[model samples]
Target chain A: MAEKKIKIIVAKPGLDGHDRGAKLLSRIFAEAGMEVVYTGLRQTPEMIVEAALQEDADVVGLSSLSGVHNYFFPKVVELLKAKKLANVLVVGGGIIPLEDIPELKKAGIAEIFGPGTSTEVIVDFIRSNVKAK
Target chain B: MFDVKELEKIKAGKKKWSEGTLAKTLSKAPEKKAKTTWSGIPVETLYTPAENAGLDYESKLGYPGEYPYTRGVQPNMFRGRFWTMRQYAGFGSAKETNARYRYLLGQGQTGLSVAFHLPTQAGYDSDHPLSMGEVGKVGAAIDHIGDMRILFDQIPLDKVTTSMTVNAAATALLGMYLSVAEEQGAKYDQLGGTIQNDVLKEIICRGQYIYPPKPTMRLTVDLIEFCQKYVPRWNSISISGYHIRESGSTAAQEMAFTIADGIAYAEACAARGIPVDSFAPRLSFFFNAFTDVLEEVAKFRAARRVWAKIMKDRFKAKDPRSMMLRYHVQTGGVTLTAQQPLNNIVRVALQTFATALGGHQSLHTNSYDEALCLPTQGAVTVALRTQQIIAEESGACVTVDPLAGSYYIEYLTDKIEAEIEDYIKKIDAMGGTLTAIEQGYIQKEIQNSAYLFQKSIDSGERAYVGVNKYTMEEPPVTDLLRVDMKVGEEKAKELKEWRAKRDNAAWKKSLDKLREVSKTDTNVMPTVIEAVKAGATVGEVCDVWRDVFGQYRPKEFIS
Candidate 1:
């Protein structure tokens, strides 16, 4: 029997129009032979979690460049928990400040990639963390 | 054919090499030179007269303001008047942005550039449910003409040239601007400025598009045709390569992709039976000035020369004005570093100098604090002062195309022109820009470049100042602008009250007419103008198009 491919959902939370990093991650993940679904920019917490659940994703990666990540990222984590997606690995990347990293991690974010983070690291991290059910 | 003993001598490092080293280096060195940047432009040890073989005074780099304007667009570029120092500044309510506008004007800013918030950009009112927590976050919030009035309260439109960084809702925004100018007693012919109404780029680089591409293209042509009649002095469309570069495209990609989109628009208008000259002269451009100082200068020069040729040869444009490429440039926001935020001021200054050297008609310097948050008052002022200092203090404005005669600059300029033409041919083969965008060809190329850039930073090949190298444990802090949460409530309340008090009958009539025009092939700008005149808000006009044209579900994916 063949191994099932790990499914992932990449989303952009809030009104951030900067999706260069997010879209690049999706392409790298797909190139690495993972199943990736990207919800384009301006995704709300509800929309992100809903898409993650619908796709049956093992990991949820959110990108926010609008500086509202502290307010928006935690909501997605909380919504995922409420919707029984607590097992899903929640990840994020953007212009997240250094001080906010720990709080975000404590809220169940698997990792955070900042501006200069490589696509390979993001792809490898998702691949390593996300396990097939 | 070459001497093998000499090549072996150079390869073994047995002798000091100079002139004869070229042939020996080619033979003995690695077959492929490792490329640092994309777009296939090689980094040489140093370029000399030999590298500039084909470049001549008369043919390659003509005098500024002449045919094949590789040097510049005007003979007196920056000597007579410096580039318009237009700072991108706006946030909070219209009242607050208006105050900032007055302050910037007082600081000697020649042009006003409006940066609307997410709600306005996406064609939603501040009161819309989707606009929660985002109202006035990125930039100023404007829902209707009432807000527009306050946004430009005391500023005279006829005197100062305004540039609105708008698309998708460009027609609606331009409609509001016209109404305001009319109220201020500024004649349409007397008004001047630019609206970045290039929707094709919205699909390529920026994702702030409201409707699908077909309807969006229709709306874009509508603005071009409408501006030709009413706002004769206004630039109907500024096809932007700025966002494309900000999205991590190379300079050549920016040049090729932008001009390809412009070509598509020109062809679109021609299809509509509008004379190409009527719209081509009003077509301006917006570009990003990156830190590759010499390469950036060369790219701008190459862009002008290439665009002039295309207008003359392909479009058969007779008027010299139609072929002139007038543009505004903004320093690349991606180049700014948040770790050592203050260092960004120096980076922006270098990039701004490159833009001025490139002969941009207008320029905007990004604030240092932008990497962390929306710019505070002091940060934006510093950015503006950067441009002012260069214009007044530096001798850069003393002559036109000061870097024009440099052997290396001319070679780089021609090289960029050739590379961009190659990409343009590839895009054209894929059925022009619209089809290429739909097929994700351009988007894929940008993503590849972005990925490689990140990989380089991660691998220590590329050294970004406070990131990857020059390690900093704690980033120095700076004050960042935080929009007051009250702004959302206040704007929502204002819109609610305005909706209740406005004349409903006339609004509906105008909206219905606008909708009817949108459904057909009729020019919708006139309908939009009438609707705006009758108090039909921007949201209402956008909603009508949203219904008729339907919303754009992005077909391309990152995968």
Candidate 2:
């Protein structure tokens, strides 16, 4: 049987209006032939988690340009766990600092892409890391 | 420029060169490299006088400061004075940001460009639950008039011009700004500055738009009218292509689409029975300057010429001041890199040179460390020094429109101007910018262009020196400036104190009056000033408007 297309929800979870990175990643996902559910600017954690469940997404990519990634990114992870969606993979990108990476990854985020990571790297990571439903 | 005899001979020579014995010698060399600006305008191997053919020098390329200002907007340009070197600075609490402003001013920064915190920009109080983890993260956090008071406490409002990058809560911020001036005993006419009251593009590119377009446009126009009536020296709206360029547009798209927004604003003001010349002179523009110096110079010249024609021919403005296109430029922020972060200095320097050559009235150079985090103090000084070096040492400011007669630059200017005008005509055919933005036409264009731009970088079609071509494994950037995490807590605590100390009854009455004014045909500025004086916070006033004019929720773009 042919493999099902990977579905992901790209979310921006704060008051930050800079959406260029989020837009770039969502388009990259679409270009890789994945099903992308883009939750545009100012989405909350509850909304992102609900959308992840509603879309039955294989991945949830959080792009935070505001320095709230330390608080907001892990909150999404916790929301997913409470919602009992253990199969979903959490990832992030943007202006997240270097020191915050370890704790975020430890909080069960699959990976984090920084500024210079190519789209091919993201595509390959999603293809290999996310397990389809 | 070229006589018919010389032109024909050159045309014949070009043809012969391409296919003749000269071609045989050139065949040994590699194929010519194709080039274009980031906006994707096609580039030729070389340009000639044939490119500027049939273009009249007197009418098309008038003298600097003349009508249809294709050369420069001012007669003497930089020789009269250097462009205001304003570096955008703000991060942390009001007290901290005040010090940063003073520091920048002491270091030769002639003006202030305030970058409010994310919650502040979104018109939320720092204590709002939604503001957690984000207060003072991007820029300064100013919740109430108290915070605004601290922000400009010592900086005399009359002496220093400020540009507030505000939109959804422009009225509230301007209210606090005016109140600050009142407390300082400064005359309204003495204050010179800009509140970036361009709401149309905020919906199209930046997602910080609060009220839907109609009311947003109302508030935008209200400020323009209010500024004209009271703050005569203030620029009401800096119609911004800077954010549009940051969001991903070809250089021409940035100019064309921004001018389209300008036309919409002018039409809206005219619809309010305000004559074009009354407010058009105070109208200003803000654009982004990128690393491509020649294209950027051409882009600026083209934009000036386009706006001159639009004001004179389209709007029938009588005053020459109304026809001039005065603008400010900021170096590209999106072009900065994380890897080998120091390379950004070179990028910023080159971009600054372009902004100067483009004859900007003002400029802000992005700090090199911005790609990593908020700029440290060290980085901001270097950024300011870049502008000073270009002005003093580079000899770029010695003359006006030095590249005016270059065949290639002239060709690019004329071509870019025509391309942008074509876009304006198309937008006009679609009814206007409002209709186009509503239909997501402009947003879709930006989205598509952004996608292609990233694809180029990914495919290595674009050479981002530190990103793809000259890749190196580097240690993580740890020396970056990070905002203290205690900012949110401290701000919330202080807000509690501010709420207790202020007279609640008067604040409530002012808010009620603000709501009443919003419902009527009254300009909201006077009421807003009263509200701030009555001790209302930015969020409280914005909440009042939100109740009156519902907050906007754009249609979901992807699923």
Candidate 3:
């Protein structure tokens, strides 16, 4: 039998509009043999979680550059946990400061990627951390 | 140009030198990897008079302040006065941003450029759910005229020019600004500044758009017409390519798309029956000064020349000011690195030098620590000092267009101009910029460029100093400016209280008038100003627009 492909949903939550990273990463993820779904700009946390649920995503990657990640990132994690999909890995990126990463991880985000992070590093992180279906 | 015999002699001598001295040098140390500019323009080994044999000095590059202003728009560039040192700043509450403004002005900054928060830019009130985490983050949150008043408190409107970087809701923001100016006892004609009121770029590069192209274009044109009549000194639209470049377009693409956008705006105004010369003079441009010094300088010069021709030949603009392309330059933000944060200071200095050499009307330098978070006071001061050093001490600003006569510079300028013209023709063929954007042509081109840029860095074809090479491990960056998380709740409560205490009946009546005006062919700025004065919030006025013109849902073009 063929190996199950990891389904990843990349979303831009809140009002931030810097989507160059998200768009590029979606393509990179697809090239790495993952099924990638990109939810366009200005998505609410509810909408992001709903995308994850509908796509049966094993991992959700969130991108926010307008500094609203603290509220929106945690809310998505909470909604996913509440929906009993806690095993799914969650990763976030964008101009996120180091001081805020601890709280974000404590809120159930698996990892946080800051600026200058390579696509290979992110792809590797998702491959290793994604939960089994 | 040289005479025919002289050109032939030089060309033959160059061939002989290439076979003799150049061949000898190549035999020992072969030329390094083939070089191309950031825009993919090939760099030659050497340039000589043969390269510019057909150059016409009179038409292509005239004297400063003359037609086809390739040298500059002003006769005495930087000798009369330096470019305005405007730092784009705002965050947290209006009071906080107001204090920052005062601090910058006290530090010898010449102008104020306000950066509104994302929610405010998208026409959302502070209390709205979509605005929950975004209030007062990227910029100050202005819910209504009350916040606008605080934002300019004690800063005399006539003393310092203010450039507000607000779009999508530009009409409401400009209305609030004009209302505040009135409160300051400043006449409309005395006000001087710019509004980055370019909405076409929002649909192409930035994602802060609220309405679709048609209605958004209406709002953009309305502001232009209103400013032409009332605010004569204010630049109505700052057609920008800074965001386009930051989104990873080549320098040639940036120049092409920006001028294309300017063409679209001029066409729109003419379609509205406004005289071309009357409004074209107030149209300004904003560009990004990237790290490629010579290429950026060439891009700016070529853009000026192209705009001058487009105005004089295409639009038949008679006024000399109408043909001039006045612009502001901000150093590239995407060049900053989070790894070796201090290196960004040097990058900013180089970009600043390029802007000064390129002849800009104003400039904004990014803080060294911006790649990590909002700049601290110390970081911002350093950025301002970088500009001051380049202006006062660098000795680069003494001559207007100092690099104008260089063979390489002139050749690059002509080549870049031709490339820009080609792109403009293609866009024109595809039914202009509006249709090109709707068909996702512009966006796809930018995305492909952005992707190629990333791939170059990823594959080590491009060497980013601290990122891909000379690697280092450093401790976490601290003392960066952090916007308080409570800024949202506080501003939301303030908005709720202000809404409750305001004259609700008056506000509703003014909004009704605005709605009625928006439906008709009449200009919407007059009623917008009235609505803000009557205590109508930004979100409320935009809600009327959303109700009438509808919101824009962009079709996802990227896979």
Candidate 4:
């Protein structure tokens, strides 16, 4: 039998309308042969967690550009943990400052990608760090 | 513009030179890569009179302030006065933003452009669940008339023109602004500013839309009709291409999509029985000034010519003012990079210069550190000074359409105009922009362009200076503006208190009136102003809209 494909959910949380990066990565992840599900703009943290559970996502990538990552990113992670999704890898990207990255990681984000990061680097990070389902 | 015999002689000379000297040089050095504009229009090795062979000077490139305003809208241009120097700034609480506004005005900035927080832009109060972590982050948090009062505190609304970058809640924001003006004893006729009330681009690129396209358009027309009757000096809608370009569209696509949107607005207004010339004059545009100086200049000129022709030929607008395409430009923010933060200053300077050459009526220069965080006061000051230096010292603004009649600029202007015409034709055939957006055609076109651009940068086909070309090992940037996390809690507490103190009976009556008026075809602007006056929060007014017209849920175009 063929190996199960990596299921990734690219989610946009909060009220940010800048989705050029989010939508671009969604296409890149799919082209990289992963099963990608993009939750459209203005998704609440709860809605994002529910989408992950329903999609059985092995990876949840959060994108926020309006500077709301500090609240929503970790909230999604905590919700996943409450649902016993501790093994699912969660990552974040957007206009996140370097100082805020360590706290986000401490809250269980596997990695945080800043601006000018290449798609190859992000895809490689996901492939290497995602826990097998 | 040249005579037939003169043009023939020049064409022959150019052919001979290209066949001999150009061919020999090409055989030796063999050009680096295919040359094209940012929009992929082919750039020739040399342009001459032949490039503008049958160009009619009168019709194609008319005098400034005339029909087919290819040169400019103002006859004297900057000789009358320099373009208004506006900076988009807001952060933290309303009082904090008010202080920043005062500081900017003190720095000699000519106009004020308000940037609202995402919660306010999306029609949510600071206390709403969706507003967590977002209040006072991107811009000032304005919930009710009280916050709006604090926002414009000492700044006299009558003396200074203010542009509010509000879309989904444009009505509420404009209502609050007008109410604050009333308190300041400013007459309605004296108010001069713009609101980015264009909602089609919100659906296409920005994604801050509240209702479906149909009802959102109704709200847009309602504001236009209201302003036409009462607020004659206010620009009702700033039909925008800036966000579309930031979302990664080519230059031609930006012009085409924006002009198409303008067409849709005029059509909607005409359908509402408002005369075409009545509201068309107040219709202004907002565009992005990218780093490509020549292409941007050409795009601006071509956009003016195209809009003039459309207003005259298609809309049958008779007033000369209705045909003018006055615009405001903001330096491209997507061009900034977090790698080498200071380089963005130079980029903004170049874009500002291009905007000047493009004959923009007003401009905003982005700060260097915006790629990392909100601009610090120091960075924003440098941005404003860059414009001042260019305006006072650069000598680029001394003449009207300084680059007009240049072989290359004229060629590119004609080419871009043709391209815009082609795209607008296609959109019209597809049952107009509204239907095209409903079918996801415009969204997919932009996405494809965005994907191709990223791929080029990733493949090293394009050199992005510090990002793709230059190698840099730099320390992490730490001196960035940080919005206090306590802002959300403070604003929520203030909203609760304000609600408790206000007369509930008046508030309920105002909201009920707004809901009733919104249901029918009556204009909602007067009722919206009354609701805000009665202490209705931004979220409360929008919730009535949400209950009436329903919220928009965009389909994910990416499979």
Best by DockQ: 4
Q: Considering chain A alone, what is the TM-score of candidate 1?
A: 0.93
Residue by residue across B1-559, what tens digits does model 4's lDDT show? 7999999999999999999999999999998888887666789999999999968999899899998999999998988899999999999999999999999999999999999999999999999998989999999999999998999998999999999999879999999999999999999999999999999999998988999999999999999998899999999999999999999888888999999999999999999999998999999999998898999999999999999999999999999999999999999999999888999998999999999999999999999999889999999999999999989888788999999999999999999999999999999999999998988888888888889889988988777889888959998899789999899999999999999999999999999999999999999999999999999999999999999999999987862
| Residue B75 lDDT in candidate 4 | 95
Q: Which residue pairs in candidate 1 have backbone atoms (N, alpha carbon, C) closer than 3 angstroms, thus clashing?
A: none
Residues B1-559, candidate 2: write the lDDT tens digits.
Answer: 6688988888877777668866687678755556877677888766777777866788878888899888788999999899999888789999999999998888888999998998877888998877888899988999888889899979999999999999888988998998898889999999999889898888887878889899989999999999999999999999999989998888888999999999999999999989998999999999998888899999999999999999999999999989899998999988888788899999999998888888889999998888778899999999999999999988889998888888888988988899899989889999999998888888878777888888888888888898989788878878788888899999999989988999999989999999999999999989999988888988898899889999998874421
Local error of candidate 3 at B484, Å? Answer: 0.8
Best by lDDT: 4
lDDT of 1 by residue, A1-133 (tens): 8868878898888767888878878877887788889888778899999998888888888888776677778888899989988888888988776667889998788898876665777878887787445
TM-score of 3: 0.98
lDDT of every predicted structure (CA atoms): 0.84, 0.88, 0.92, 0.93
Worst 10 residues of 3 chain B by lDDT: B31-40
Sorting all predicted structures by TM-score, with the top scorer first, yields 4, 3, 2, 1
| Residues B77-152 of candidate 3: C-alpha lDDT, one tens digit per residue | 9999999999999999999999999999999999999999998899999899889889899999999999999999
Q: Tell me what fraction of the real C-alpha contacts between chains A and B each candidate also makes.
A: 0.40, 0.62, 0.66, 0.75
Per-prediction DockQ: 0.48, 0.65, 0.76, 0.77
RMSD of each: 4.4, 1.5, 1.2, 1.1
User: Which residue segments of model 4 deviate by more than 4 Å?
Assistant: none
Model 1, B451: alpha-carbon shift in Å?
Answer: 1.7
Q: Would you list the clashing residue pairs of candidate 3?
A: none
